[model samples]
Target: MSSDLEPHGRIGVVRLGDALDWSTAPDVRTMVSTMWDDLAGGCLVLDLAATTFCDSTGLGTLVSICTDSGERGVRLIVAAPPPGVLRMLRITGLTAFFELYDSAEDALRSARAGR
Candidate 1:
């Protein structure tokens, strides 16, 4: 729903909205992709706590972001995804691809600790 880019770091936060179907899929991708150039070498933390639903495309976008981040040597972490989205992540086995967290603060703390 909202995104916050911390200054002078590769850290960014994207708050996913409730509906992550086809309609908003492109926008979500664009929004998240834009962060790549903006915060090129930093970690990108996606906060999905507000997301109530996620379709294949939505999940695809997340995977793409993670891949893109890896290519750029920037870490992408998905945190607090809603139950449905979490289920999708588990189903897709992407739960292991991302650093799942219970909250945005925890994700950030983990990201910091890893550094």
Candidate 2:
């Protein structure tokens, strides 16, 4: 998997590519953790538009990130998740646990408005 970080004022957008599975989830977690200093009290948009697959490990990673973000006062938003990922989140009853948007722009706008 690949990830790119883009900062827009107080919002940090992380665009994830390829697949988010067991092998990549740890890296993703580390990447996000390392950016916490820059993202604290700001918003984080996980742009998963290019991510094609997400396994159980990926879902767990996402949940952990969301929980940690809350503790750090960072808002975690998921944008453009593929159908499979969305389905997995729903099946796991995490749809209500996360803030989701159709696109990164939408998520960014919403986060900005809330601020």
Candidate 3:
């Protein structure tokens, strides 16, 4: 697993570099949630290009994060998810629940435009 933190313009980007499984899901959720209060505007760009797989826990955590962010008016954009993960999101009817992008650049651009 690997990861990186970066700023794509004004959006804080957290790229997960590992396959999201039961073992790492909680940590990922906690880390992102903690970062919520630290990022300016509470907006985030999640780069999931390296995320190969995810389970219900990962999806649930994402949903929880979305719910929390919505209450605080924070925008969370997920970009470049693998096919498996994307399929899961689609199956759960959550594709409409988030702003998804094909790349980190795209997500950043959209975030900037919305700002």
Candidate 4:
């Protein structure tokens, strides 16, 4: 957990740990979901630039998170993924499914504007 439940009004920013693999993916999901539910309308921005690697479990957890957000009538934004993480998302066709931002600031701005 790089950052705790850092809430900036309705938009929450969760800095995913340095590695998002099987060991950390579950916690990631829990943190984001917990924040989403707590925030109402569930606007979240996940900062992934510090993350060096993400495995299948991480990717799957992301999908699950996205689904949960949608079911709650919101979307999750992800920002600044490292090279390996970006490649995996592209290869898995998840890049199109997510709203990717160049920076956390940009993602948060968008989240706020959507309100």
Candidate 5:
């Protein structure tokens, strides 16, 4: 499991691992939650371009983050999720629960634009 977080003005950009399964969910969640708490305001953009896999547990953690974001009045978005992960979201009917973008930049633009 490998990931990196980069802070953009008003946005926390997360470049996630190749696989986000049970083995990686906890750390990912912790890093993201901490970042969100630190940000106080703005949006979270998960750059899934390098992510090749995601399991139900990983998806659940993401949903948890999304839920927390709503309570914090922060937006949560996914940028460039791989085809498999995207399909899983669709299959699980979770696609509607998130803002899907082609890239982190697009996500930031839409979020800042209040779209």
Candidate 6:
């Protein structure tokens, strides 16, 4: 799996790769944690448009990140999640816990408007 961090002013977009499973979840968590200082009080968009798979551990990592972001006053958004991931989130009842968007651009727009 691969991930890229793109910072657009106060909004940070993390573009995730093909898979977000057990082996990659920890790395993702660490990547976000490492960038926490820069992202604090801003917005974070997890760009999952390229991500094709996500396991339970990946979902747990997302929740952990969301909780941490909330505590740090950062807005967490999940953007462009594929059908599989979306289904898992819905089945797990996490759709309400996260701000979902159809694209990163939409997320950034909402964040910019302070929504």
CA lDDT scores, all candidates in order: 0.83, 0.86, 0.76, 0.78, 0.80, 0.86
Q: How many angstroms is residue 39 displaced in model 4 relative to the true structure, after the best TM-score fit?
A: 2.8
Off by over 4 Å in 1: none
Cα lDDT over the full model 6: 0.86
lDDT of 5 at 12: 71
TM-score, candidate number 3: 0.84
How do the residues 1-115 of candidate 3 rate in per-residue lDDT, one tens digit apiece? 3334445443567788666767887787777766665564647778888887788888887788778778766788988888898899999899999889988788878877874
TM-score leaderboard ranking? 6, 2, 1, 4, 5, 3
**Which candidate model has the greater lDDT, 1 or 3?**
1
Candidate closer to the true structure by TM-score (higher is better), 1 or 6 = 6
Error of 6 at 26 (Å): 1.4
How well is each residue in 1-115 modelled by candidate 5, as lDDT tens digits?
3334445556677788788889988888878877766556777788888888899998998899889989887778899888998899999999999989988678768867767
TM-score of decoy 2 = 0.90
- Model 6: number of clashes? 0
* Model 5 misplaced stretches (Cα beyond 4 Å): 1-8, 112-114
Number of the top TM-score candidate: 6
- Which segments of model 3 are wrong by more than 4 Å? 1-10, 40-42
Candidate 6: tens digits of C-alpha lDDT, residues 40-107: 77888899999989998899989999999999988899999999999999999999999999998898
In the predicted model 3, the residue pairs found to clash are none
How close is every model to the real structure, measured as TM-score? Answer: 0.90, 0.90, 0.84, 0.87, 0.86, 0.91
Which whole-number lDDT from 0 to 100 does residue 90 have in model 3? 94
Error of 3 at 15 (Å): 0.8
Against the true structure, candidate 4 has what lDDT?
0.78
**Candidate 2 lDDT by residue in tens digits, 1-115:** 4444445656777788788989989889988887788877888889999999898899999999999999999989999999999999999899998999999889878988874
